[model samples]
Target: SDPKAEYIGTEPWTPKEALEGGEITDKADIFAYGLTLWEMMSLAMPHLELLEGEDDEKEVEEDEDQSLEVSFDEDAYYDRLGTRPAVDLEALGNSYRRMVELFYLCTEGDPVRRPSAAQILQALESNVPLNINPSEVIVID
Candidate 1:
């Protein structure tokens, strides 16, 4: 509830104030949704280490280089979000594919290309599952 408070879990948790509902899309859910994509791809909840009494500012130290970006190896499937996550893609339906694609799309570097919540919901309904076997999800974490 405090802006100064640190964010904890791997998945974003929206507050009641965040969902007042006037806006078409909420950034809070979008963040969680992005993590969900990584979750579905990596097959695990994106984990963030619990802070151990350090100030929130002190706990986060992001690399300044533009090249130091977040990327998945897409080869080693052992971990996602710093945790082991494997999904049974073969078990998922066609619709699931399109949803993941949309997740990745919404998480694009260019936010303009990302779809709004309403649009995301609409797009996911199409459900054109990807041919990539969820079980073969290899990634280098």
Candidate 2:
């Protein structure tokens, strides 16, 4: 695990209400785990926007303050688009991609909608669908 993984629990993944002076909870930890899981699976890709057109040089501006920052774009995240990195479902294959879906459940915009850590563990233990035929699995684009 990356040493900075601890930061996930405190910032953008820390739920909007918490940032607005609400009490933090175990749910925050679950959110962090979801994010860490995505990083682990995707080999730590930057959580940035897709480059427009053919200009491979297009880049999301970096924060000069920190060299190794994960995106903390809470606004775009709550709006459900720009902030998060894109996952290539076809490349990840079915099982790994399903694990990525778990991140969405853990990081739902509404805290109440996010799953508890126990629920996440139970789901993981119960579901072992990775070995299924890739052609038959329908991944969300």
Best by TM-score: 2
lDDT of each: 0.43, 0.54
Looking at model 2, how many pairs of residues clash? 0
Q: lDDT by residue for model 2 over 96-129, one digit each (tens)?
A: 7667788666655555556765567767898743
lDDT at 96, model 2: 79
TM-score of each: 0.36, 0.55
Report the C-alpha lDDT of model 1 over 20-59, residue by residue, as the tens digit. Answer: 3222223344545665775666554444333333454324
Show the lowest summed lDDT stretch of 10 residues, model 2. 132-141
Model 1 score (lDDT): 0.43
| Backbone atom clashes (below 3 Å) for every candidate | 11, 0
